[model samples]
Target: MKHTKVKDLLKSTTTLQEVNAKGWVRTFRNNQFIALNDGSTLNNIQCVVDFENTPDEILKRITTGAAVSVTGELVESKGAGQTYEIQVKKIEILGDSDPDKFPMQPKKHSLEFLRENAHLRVRTNAFGAIMRVRSVLAFAVHSYFQKKGFVYVNTPVITGADAEGAGEMFQVTSLPMDKLPKNEEGAIDYKKDFFGKHTNLTVSGQLEAETYAMALGQVYTFGPTFRAENSNTSRHLAEFWMIEPEVAFNDLNDNMDLAEDFIQYVIKYTMDKCGDDLKFLEGRLLEEEKSKPQAERSELALLDKLNFVLENNFKRVSYTEAIDILRNSTPNKKKKFNYIINEWGADLQSEHERFLVEKHFKCPVILFDYPANIKAFYMRLNEDGKTVRAMDILFPGIGEIVGGSQREERYDVLVEKMKVLGIDEEELSWYLDTRRFGSAVHSGFGLGFERLVLFVTGMTNIRDVIPFPRTPGNAEF
Candidate 1:
């Protein structure tokens, strides 16, 4: 009989099940024991091989990470550490990896060291857990939206304009960076650039997704977004994935409802399918946060706040109200914020965001009608004249996981906002045409996909969630 996976066999304590297994030897110890893993999980299994019963030549060839096929009798070992192990009956070497040249040995590596080797980092348990959780979350996102009848739309990677209106954009080029066409201002003429006229990788797909949602009623785009920001923080990456869903006839409140439901469903799905992985991440986060008790264990801290959000209905606060709460709060003294959180006008920073979700409301906070001046140009202007129908869904550990707004479906208002923001109407003529033809009231939000993975898996760093991180100054992988 072919041996089953060691991890699977360990789950069942059945005796005398003959199995065949093929995997890399994780650790060979005490002359007769082999610790093996088959890219299953963080925990590998210990298989006790009786050398006297095996071919000496095969035994001699078996080295750490050497691929071997093993025929074994499953035994519920009366062992001290592991519950069950494979009793080897036969062994055959499939391939041998040179232990010296290979980066990974049985020895442990620092996370910083592993960061240097992002390519092969997936072989490690933490990365495996992260990758698996990321995969499951991506599925959950698609499944959640698809089941709700949201059409999937693939947005462009390279585009003529930046979506976020954020200036940080990576230049796309068919020509070499050094040998680019220059004009009178000694600037490379971007008209000759790929796709022409200063095109760069997209920063968000919300605007494009809106074009479809106006027609399709409900649509979403899940894909890569790029930025050229040089800040090397744990959470910021040059290239990241975002899930932006736009829904026609949806107001800001409806958008929040969708956001909350989407978040809850994703969390529940992750917890259900990747419980072991989640637990692993939980433990991992606990370890990671130990050094920053103030940051981790603050009143409106990440873990506690996320657990609260995951378990309960989110609290709603108007941005104006949130600002008032922050201004009048005792906790504001501790935040040491440069910007005043006095009233309805300020952009909520991480500190103010933490205050509302973690400290003030002590629940997930959906604050709406952010100042029109501070918000993106596409947001619908509220009756108050100062605010736009933009909402940010902020959680405890993470600040704003989602940013969305009800779009000004009216052509004139949208055109005016775009003009005020100095967004070129000539470039966005197609977008304006949607309003001219069949534009309807629609709202959408951009959920930083890495942020969700970070929140769900308890991963703190943006680098930890992505397989091959593309932070500024580093695209090695």
Candidate 2:
């Protein structure tokens, strides 16, 4: 608590001017030297100490991940490689860390190894960069929405079912799984679940967002969204953060603009607000590693793309054109498509989406009017008898960062669409009733917060973005 935060260290003339700064040991070397990163700046303040001056007990207590505070003089170094360092006056022991027990160390390790110890991984340079940038991106979201007069609404996480209708929900029941009663069809009776009515975590907050938007005129909900799908992919997490902004008296076009502007704001915000953290990552991969893996290369490319796209405009492409373009492309392009997106009705795969945005548009492109059957039921139908008013903003590396649409404000159309989707109508009375009482044209979209972090920070895995990732077969702390 007595130490300065890592962010407060800005420049040598400013923070380094103190010379006698205190911080924990990120790593050590030469038995007489220590690297102190106060977590205030991207650069760590290197401290050189002779073993004679430093106590054996203090050195014995110290480890790679140990927490220590050093009071030292800022020494300007112009060695063959090194530029700046700190001359130690004395070092104090704030906490002792055992190297064998500490999860992170100076030696190179895989990201998978660190995922097992999330709580401790923040001490690492890469994760520290990611976590700090995540904080910045989240702040950017709130700042952008609030600055535009958008009310931040906290919607209910528990309620009578009726969100995504994915048939995937964790029963919040008091009864033991073995003791719960079953229907004649052998399904567990949800009546035995908590609240007596069926309920689970929400997959999306759009409906609740729309309700708030109707009253507040413009509202946004940023919270946790849960899905029960047992997916093992890097992009799929059972629990993740979602940002949904709803606007009343707006259509799909307005919604797209909002999504584009908001995304640009987040990326630019991270670059501006978290310049130090990103610079740390850039140095680690670019300078230290010589070059990075393909994924990391892709990540850097995206940061460059975001910097340009945020300032420029976005390209708009229709579903029909996207399909035709995919169909017309040559067969052998060494392109790895997750699935075929040719023809109007085929569901767009991640690969196809990446192609359209990265290849065709060459920038962040807004792909609109997706096929009705493939999209959510709330999306407004198109006059072309094929697509819905859904706009997905796809950037170069990450595909489909934003998924949103204009809702069918007309009660009759909404009800019909629900029927077609096999959803019962009576259960959603509160939502449907909104239509009866001045539910004007409204639009909103959900941007996966983790996806935004992955894009901004140049981290590849979604598991690393979330501190405790809940994924298939893996929920380790």
Candidate 3:
């Protein structure tokens, strides 16, 4: 008999007589009921077995994480939890999980312990819910752009250009590290490496995506991006997925509009499609927050928080205005901020961003028109000569969910800015050509895909959201 997926079986309006189901056993209760899940849905279909008729040998194999196939009659369940269940006629153990050796037992485990076994962590209810939400959100991201007539662009993972010029990039080389070839000046000769010049895993696809956007008019790139930064904070990851969208003839306002709509669309899509998983995660968050003080607990539930973002408009504030608000705020006044906001040019830290999003605005906030010296060189310089048309969308929990700006379109001004920033002009001549030839106003932003997942899944640590996270001093499978 053909196997019916757990998701479909649970959604069936009428129960069938003889249905085959295959899945891992989540738990065996009372030696009669087997909770089975096949990763199709968060809910498990209760499989009732006749313990008296079943042999002891077959019944003993029904341990957690064991794979099994059951031939049964799907019927309206009399059980309290599930609406439908399988009355097993025959069961076969495809694979057995030794309860003593299985790391994930039927009990609550610490997040750190689960992370160590990330390879098998998805089998857990929490991780399963998270990964499902992540998958749904990923599809939402693609669907949202595709429906908008945006071309999906595949940018190179390896590139010679440093989009941010941050110097913190994972260098890609094929030369022997122990016996690296040296030049006449005694410097390591990158000419002997792959690509005949220094190249690294791309930090951002924005630059290459811009090349396509110039011709395609509107395009977005969703792919893995590498950053060599060693920060081991909960928010930073060495390797992560990035979503970058570049559109031609867009100014700062258009960029903000695109970002706001894009985020809300994806979030709403995930919430709608993965309601079961989201509800589970919301309950999980509520339970986790119970240990904290009442005042520190979340004011709104996860679903409410998500809905609130979708319902309200993001508060748009200039960098200058944000600075004044921060300086006058209680945290800054009490010298509680780690990086105190003293002047306009001071970059906003996570503390400042959270305060604006969670405390003052009580909604997502868009901070724009940042100081040119503080923002990237590619950001469009405003007429004031001091600030750039940069924007960052700050979420309640996730500080900066999206960072983008109106690109500097003028050739001479861009070159001068690059020179002042000490960025090599010759290496980026290919990028500058877009501006040189026929550049109109263009803008884009890079959203950390994992952060979005973290927000949607209601997970605190960024590592928990991404599978097999690569953090500082940790690359375990």
Candidate 4:
């Protein structure tokens, strides 16, 4: 009658008289033992079928990827891998999958091959574990913010402003491309568009979240953000989720403290809740790394790496100090890095960041007081006229896990900075309003959700963590 999840059934203390378990058949061995998984957990429950009594036709339909419901008695399993097994009394095929056509079989599949079959990839053990850990981490994000009395705000996905000041946003328009309307100067008339102005998908919700933070005192947004960048690197994703938290009356130090605590809290929470999944991923990573040389392998295991972050304080270093460290480092001195760090104002790349975290510091590092010219327009400019009160939290594997800064609260300085950057005063007047009226010092940072998943799950590729990754020239499910 009532179906029990595989995860719950496996943990049962007493044997049940009759239980209904529904899941896709992972494998049917010897026409008697069935490995069934319903995605509730990483492990599958063994379902033993009586092939002598079952019809041959029904047995033939019990193929891999086929959905089936087995009514059976839950008892102690004689199997070695699992503790519980289902003694099936009746078998019903909810959906039949042809063994010849099903893409995922009972065998090892490359991550690349699984990426190609994104829709059906979750049936595999690795993807299933990854998705479970991802779900738990997402919940942990909200739990951390909510428990801290932070108001959850939903910023508009479609906005007229580019929060990051990067022009690589996806344009949202309803106007016909071929029959485009033009102005007197032959420029495309945005007035005829749906929003009556040029609008793009938001790159960050930080600017909008600031408005709420000013009134609400503390606010956070967890939502989808889009970028039109064409890079196909393992770290870059055209579409990804960002978790941004903006707080009022906070400075650079307060922002750093908030970010460090928030990150550690979420990571610890994920580790606590997704213990089984994390263990599975740890083993998966260990197995995967066996193919590589010892020098290239990660020194710490997945769980240990996570616990290390929780146990240690993030080393706080200034941008100037980090630049000095990088400039004198072996890679930069020997011209090994792709981008040399010889100058002060040069933007730090991933290679430089990894060196700081993994090699030099050997722990998470927060580099602050960035050069003003390289940072966004909203960051507070330092009195020295060279740097801004900005910071980036660098992780060992993931370079920059979080980016934030103490916002420019002074209206005059903000206007002057916008004028210098050629940013439209009228276009972002709404954002300027926060500074214009009672703008106290406020700070916020955006954490790339996918990157967090990538780090926690120990998955190398960013595309592997997010479902149905949208990359350049590829949008297949």
Candidate 5:
């Protein structure tokens, strides 16, 4: 018999005569009721077992985390929490779980504990909801780009170029580390590596995506990217996903518009499709926030915060203006910010970003025209000779949700910038070809996919948003 998903079974209008439901046993209460979940939804299906007729051995095996198949009549539940439940006629234990050994029992478990059991964490209500929302958000990302006539491009996972110029990439090599090959200068010989050159996991697909955008007019890449940074903060992940969209003939302003619209569209889509999951996450967040002081808690609920973003336009401020605002703000005045904004060229930290979004602007913000020295070499240099056409979209809770800029289309200017920055001209000759051949004014931005997921799910830690988070010293599955 085909087993029905818990999500579909719960939405059934008419009572079915017999239905097969297969799920992991969340709890077996009073030896009669079974709370079964199959990860189709956050809600569990209550399977009432015939404990009197069932053998003691079979009943005893129905433990938490046990995989069970229940053949039952679908009927209106007498339970208060749920409407429909299964009246079990037959039950089979597909996989037995020892109650004494199962880590995830039917109780509240700390997120830290669940992180250790990352493989089994999704079985919990909170993680299940988060994953579902994440799946929908991913779909929404592709949907938004596809509907707008954007071609989805798969950029290479391994590349010799560091797109972000951060130089914090995980090196991909097949050469034996024990018997390392050395050059005449005693440096490691990368020419003998698998790719016949130094290569690493891509940090961003923006540079590659730009090449496709130059020809295809519009292109976007959604793929995994790696960073070898050692920071073990809530926001930093060694491995994460990035969404980079490159478009032709778009300037800094156009890029900002595209980013704002794209983000709002995806957020609205997730809210529409994952209503139940979002509600669960919102409740989870509220419950978790109970331990915090009123001042530290979020002012708006999860749903309300999402709705607020959709209703209002993100406030746009120049970087110079933002620096002035930060320098005169309460935090800087009271020495609250860890990295105080003392001057114009200072990079804005998370605290400064939060103040602009949550305190000063009281909405999402777009800070543009950053100092050229601080931004990447690919960004278009402004006429002021000091700033570049770079922009960062700042959210209330998440500091920089999206970072992008109008790319430098002039080949001469790009080469000069690369020369000054000591970037290899020969190494990125292919990227420069986009400018060499028919480089029209183009723009693109990269949205850290995990950051978007973090904001939408209201998850504080970036690790929780992505499955199998790879941090500095921890790579446990």
Candidate 6:
């Protein structure tokens, strides 16, 4: 008989006399019951062994992490924890796991310890639930875009230009470090490199996605993005995934509408499809937060928080207005803010954003029209010549989840802005061609894919959401 997934068997309405199940053993209890997981869902199916009829050698091999296949009869479970379980008639050990050697036993493990063993961490209940939610959320992202007639674009992972203008990027080179070639002026010869010029892993796919959007009308890119920043924080990752959507003829207002609606839709879909996983994660979060002070604990439950986002509209405000509120805020007056908002044009930090979302507004906030000096060169300039048509969407727990702006469509304006910022116009002539030929007001935002996963999973650390996290100095397995 064909093997049935544990998820399907668990959801079965009728018990079967003959059924086959194959998975890795999670635990063996009282020499009779075996908990097995197949990565189909967060829940594991319990398999009851007839130990009196079974051999001692087979029972000893049924250790944690051991791969096993069992042919059994599905019956109503007598145990208190599960509704139904398998009555194993025949069992085979595909692989054996030594109890002394297995790192992940049926016990509680710290997140730090789990990070060290990331390759095998998926076997844990928390990690398994997180991965399932991540997969469902990813599908929701694709479904939301494709259903809206948006073309999915695969932008190149390697590019020749610094699209973000912030030059903290990882360089891709093929030349030997010890035996490097030099030019007449003793500079490293980039012509001999793989791309015949300096190139690096892309930090964002927005620029390339824009090219397609100009032609395709609507396009989105979902792919891995890399940065060489050395910050080792819970929120920073050297390599992460980014989801960027570009729409032609979209002004700042249109961009905001798209972002808000898109986020709500995908999150709702995940809530609908992955209800069991979300519930497990929600309980996990509550247990983890028990050590925190009462004041620091979340005011709403996980489901309530997610429902709040869908039920209410995000507060929209201008940068100037946000600055004014921050300047007079209690934190600013009490010197609690690490960097006080003393004047206008000051860049908003993570703390400031959290305050706006958690305390001041009590909801997600979309701040727009930021100072031109603080934003990117490609953002459309406001008539006041001081601020750009930029916006950032701040969430309750995760400060800035989305950032975007209306693109500068005029050739002369874009070129002048690039010149003022000391960017090489010749290097990005192809990008300029969009404005040179035909350009319209366009807008898009990039949502950090891992951050979205982190939010949905109720995971505090960004590293926990990603399977193999790449940080400043850690790249193990």
CA lDDT of every candidate: 0.81, 0.77, 0.92, 0.93, 0.93, 0.93
The better candidate by lDDT, 2 or 5, is 5
- State the lDDT of candidate 6 residue by residue for 1-477, as single tens digits: 899999999989999668999999999999999999999988889999999999999999999999999999999999887888999999999998989989999999999999999999999999998999899899999999999999999999999999777548999999999999999999999999988999999999999899999999999999999989989889989999999999999999999999999999999999999999999989988987898999778877788778877887999999999999999999999999999999999999999999998899998899999999999999999999999999999987778999999999989999999999888999889899999877888999999999899877878899999999999889998
lDDT of 4 by residue, 439-458 (tens): 89999999999999999999
TM-score of every candidate relative to the true structure: 0.92, 0.90, 0.98, 0.98, 0.98, 0.98
The per-prediction tally of clashing pairs is: 6, 3, 0, 0, 0, 0
Regions more than 4 Å wrong, model 5: none
In order of TM-score, best first, we have 6, 5, 4, 3, 1, 2
Query: What tens-digit string does per-residue lDDT give for candidate 1 at 399-463?
Result: 89998999988899888888877888988898888899977888989899998888776766788
Cα-lDDT of candidate 3: 0.92
Q: By summed lDDT, which 10 consecutive residues of candidate 3 come out lowest?
A: 159-168
lDDT of 3 by residue, 1-477 (tens): 999999999999887678999999999999999999999999999999999999999999999999999999999999797889999999999999999999989899999999899999999999999999999889999999999999999999998878687548988899998899999999999888889999899888888888889999999999999889879788889999999999999999999999999999999989889998999999999999998899678777899889978999999999999999999999898998898888778878888998999999988999999999888899999999999999999988768999999999899999999998888989888899999888989999989999999888888899999989998888886
Q: Candidate 1 vs candidate 4: which has greater TM-score?
A: 4
In model 2, how large is the Cα lDDT of residue 321? 87
Tell me the spans in candidate 3 whose CA falls farther than 4 Å from its real position. none
- 20-52 in candidate 5: lDDT tens per residue? 999999999999999999999888999999999
- What would the TM-score be for candidate 2 when compared with the true structure? 0.90
Model 5 clashing residue pairs (backbone): none
